[model samples]
Target: MIQDRYSLAFRLYPYARSADQDATDPVRHPVVIMGGGPVGVALALDLGLQGIPVVVLDDHEGIGQGSRAICFSKRTLEICDRYGAAGPMLDKGIAWTLGKVFHDDRKVFEFNLLPEDGHRFPAFINLQQPWFEKFLIDRVRQAQAEGAPIALRGRNRVDAVAPRDDHVLLDITTPEGPYRIAADWLIGCDGASSPLRGMLGLGFVGEVFKDSFLIADIRMKADFPTERWFWFEPWFKSGASTLLHRQPDDIWRVDFQIGWDVDRAEELKEDNIRRRLDAMLGDGVGYDIVWSSIYTFQCRRMERFRHGRVLFAGDAAHQVSPFGARGANSGLQDVDNLGWKLGMVIRGRAPEALLDSYHEERAHGADENILHSTRATDFITPKTPISHVFRNAVLDLAERHAFARPLVNSGRLSVPCSYDGLSLTGVDGLGGPDRTRPGSPCPDAPLGDGFLLPRLGGDFVILAIDAEAPETMTQDGVTARRLAVSAAQDPSGALAARYLGAAPGAVYLIRPDQHVVARWAQYDETALRAALRRACAKE
Candidate 1:
């Protein structure tokens, strides 16, 4: 029998207790990831890439149900590329750049995601969450075949979690029996309603939006442009706002704000779904509903992501309203932020203090994502009578005036959060342009007909632009790879202009995760090494 492409099940091997040892026998690993979701699997791959041994435990045998997270951002694509899954994703996912907003019946404004010319990935890709997870699982399997030292154990549910000062203990229940395992570091990627988070006694804090949303994914044969279209109080839906997005396989992901008092069971009935679809998409439109779900989200996060040797990443640590596609994107960023630091600490290449920066930076990222999503949620569904009036006024004014257009916020969309003035490197380094600031993601540009980010992440790099490569950079026991960019590598001069506007020579100290640590107008080895140490959290 052939496996369903949408729902692929992998065989689950039993983790039976040893004949001599009972369930009390403690099997230990360096890093044990608690969820086999995208964040956990990505972290496993990232650690495996760094030659760190890991064990990933998942209760489910395969990917989750439905298209959970559909929008994949450019930064997210880059991160996936590093983990060897972006190529398949870009090919299979629907790549879109343009978006149109509507108020009532008039198409208010057309906006672009500001996609550039040189980067390999587009601004965004609309793919089902299941497909994305499948891709990640494929990469994980490939890594396992290549001896990455990663154990992906399916159907192994974590029953209990005990955090120690030095190690974390996990009680895993499988088909054969229940056994206990210990880990040097435990990452909770278990997602919202996370069991590990509850067991750890981490307090979740934030506001829950009063409005509920219904997401409907349907397969339709329509010649609609592959773009995001959102409406505020559309004539068809009267007082509600609706969002329309295109996914792969001629699938359309539609969302409508149904308010808080919805009888979800009644609302999700076939007749109700058909009525809503007919109102917006025409009654005779050739379509088949794939799936639909009602959701009410909260922009909340844990008080702390780090609890001794245990850490939280992805939806387990923070959850934002799904409007901005910040949930999984930010989760992957948390993986990116923590993966390298954890790997280094495990390898004894960096001090345990290095993990502090991960907490600081990811907490900052989670907070930033929460802030943007909260603002979007508020604008989409204002609570106060006065607030709704002002919102209506802004939407009405946006149709006529240019200045009011900027005030409209269907969703701010996920953007890279600048880690300026943080404990890791203090502030954004003195840079050529604001784009190349410290704590910002390394910009991807045409480099020798390829891209810049491909060669940057997974290691420390000293990018010397239009200047001689810095002298053998051996900084604080670790050596940095020196990249020399010339007119040839940066054929169109876009990279040079972005990194070295008018400056004669420039050096950017990039971290293992491809974040700019420091940039100097000139290459001074001493200053560069000191900056590297600061980035590594070595005072």
Candidate 2:
């Protein structure tokens, strides 16, 4: 019999005789996430908050070294806050307000993300990925300390994943032994060359840039502003591109272009790499190289995010060039999109069909991001003769035309993606479309006593204007509140138009993920109830 009560064997077979007996048994969890990267960890944390049990497995001993993605947008920070992970991240991260784009030595364009918003948080934060991972790990540990049935298995590699009609099974091997885990759902966040995606016969189809870039993390002694990210085109004597960002520990991340013609093995030498860094920083400045690697840029996305009971997320589902910093940010959004829907289905609140929207919505967003990042890469480092000429022309035009600056910067950064044509987001009316129409993210508004946006709990929100005598509508287990509104009292014109159209009273139901599920101009209890039922049931 198992002596330890909390051992895997004991958990799998409480009355098991030995390891051999437990091997014949199956370990089950509501959700099983493969890969312990940020996306996988975020999903686990989010689900754990929802009182769901999750098992996360990864092959690495701990968070990997080097700075991969160091930028976090306000939207992502909001999601992290929902799980109570934002405070520590904010304290440890560097909040950046400015970013500049340059060509040769001349500044072409610049943007300041800070604006007049009631939000207490900054618009963007930059932190080393290793430290960021540690922050998340700490959060996960704290939640587990509070009795969440979440488990993390490091140094464990997933050998195979098999999806059946009812459940998905994962075969994972550790130093101890091979184990079988049966889960209601399997999320593959295993990076670009995902074995799970391959096992499911899913193919990622898109373009791969022939050029390669070198990334280096080094400690610098120069007097450079630590608050902004700098990009250089036709950089250094070799005329390759370069990028620089500040990290928390006085360390800086630099990306230098290594032409495809360079020998990968010989070019990565410590001396050669140090020489390039010295040249970039000038001879007087002393620095120590922390890490370095060569990576090829690709813009590919999985044809389908969902394959039976197995779903792909993060880099496993799609990949974009590093130019726009969309790769990690997009993956975080993928988990955000799927986390709640998975909870709804697993908890029997919504039908399985609701999960289909994951592929439909995220694939579109992934394609759009890929296009954006690809354009940014081409603009920064023109590979072809035609592109080289066009890049120079655009740079010259941007110098004279203020309108051209925004266009050039559009593809170089992150923007909130929308699901305009999604079946779940509802129809766009024929009238003047409100900027915050159905299917778009709910805009932030100030409440009498504090900010209203951050106060929205993780569940779907029903914003009814009337404080007293607000009518309640329930459908298919989904509920909504109807409020009486006056045109004169409407603070946000967009919200008023979205819910009430031209009417004075209206009802709007928002999803847990912040997309509008349904809206009505006039509140009719019966009709509103039916809409709620259909949306909640998601037939």
Candidate 3:
């Protein structure tokens, strides 16, 4: 019998228990993060990379149960790569970009998520959430070994939050006892149903689906490819949807859209699970159910992520249905956006108002995710009979008609959210691909034996494409280096095709978080510096 144990827990991180502290006074930290999950750990590593001290408190001692959040997006992989976790993750992940949609007996259109190849990583990969967390934790520990200022305190739960003018105080309950601490700035990556959110009495508003889905990770010697296969009313199961994915260690992740009013306990039984597997994989196909779970879909977000000196990220700030793999991916982007800006605020480089961009940017991301997931859920499990008939018609049309294929949404795969017209978006100096424009993630291209994303990460950079390299450009604690590019720099001309198009002598100003802020037809030092200031919220 596979015992359900949180036994994957890592060793305890030593921390002092301070039960006695004046209500007005507490030991202060630069950044106090509540939640040591992927989002919290990513924030800690990002702050540590900037030499900023951060304290992470989580009630759990180790990684969470089951193979949760299985699909990792390209943007997420890029962020993980920046934090030094991608190498291990890539080694243990099953990379794929192809997905086929099956409508009962007929096969609908298949998709190649990333048809082109200049980027360093694939469109998506499947890895257990626990393994991904362990990789990020290992990176955090490595940074700690190298004297990075990060303290991860496991089994430390924040019980109270007292937001102040300049700092936020936290009352924590530990395994040993209760204690209090303060932070110059507080961030809650605590996840869905966050204690910190409840303590602050924030509103999480969104839609909830009526149907429940079952996730079962099975170990079997079947011929399932790494590619994703989503079905609608396949004969092997009930008249519902099913998703198949391959993960590490020969494990297959199967999600069955078990309708509402199901006997969850009975369905989760080993006999029932094995019976379902037998029906799907045939009686002769040997398999073992490793993990099984049933969960209702929800699409919700807080009214605001920033509340005084305390902020929220990840599921604490917002949540989406698990359809698009946006929950964890968007949360990682939240850390990517907040980490640099928060570090700047701590270093006195940018005004505290810069943190507002974190809320603006990530809330935008959350909205996009929620919108996509809600649409997917509605299509997957139509509340009305008319909606279900329409969905079936779309599927039937998708089988033969190319135009109808665009209407099909087997979870409209996760993608980066663009901040095109936000307050920080500078001038779009030239035209480019839809994804390579201002306020978008930089389009990756091959750079001298490596890719462009690694080089673009960690700092604000100005790329001098087909232009003279600028001598120097610096703004409020932000320095921009000129990286000259030529036809020789990109032999495949992908960089030019994506960034410059037909325009020559173009330059782009990229933010520290790797989002394109502005571009210029020519590298004007004055305009470049101004854009840098605007990007950092110092203008």
Best by TM-score: 3
- Which parts of model 3 are misplaced by more than 4 Å? 1-25
User: Which numbered prediction scores highest in lDDT against the true structure?
Assistant: 3
Q: Pick out the ten consecutive residues of candidate 1 with the lowest summed lDDT.
A: 1-10
Report the Cα lDDT for residue 487, model 2.
37
Query: Which of the predicted structures, 2 or 3, would earn the higher lDDT when compared with the native?
Result: 3
Estimate, for each residue in 62-143, the C-alpha lDDT of model 1 and write its tens digit. 7757897999999999999999888899999998889999988998898899546878889999999888888887887888
Flag the better candidate by lDDT, 1 or 2. 1
Judging by lDDT, tell me the better candidate of 1 and 3: 3
Candidate 3: worst-modelled 10 consecutive residues by lDDT: 1-10
Clashing residue pairs in candidate 1, if any? 421-427
Segments in model 1 whose C-alpha atoms lie over 4 Å from true places: 1-24, 426-430
Q: What is the overall TM-score of model 1 with all chains considered together?
A: 0.95
Q: What is the full ranking by TM-score, best candidate first?
A: 3, 1, 2
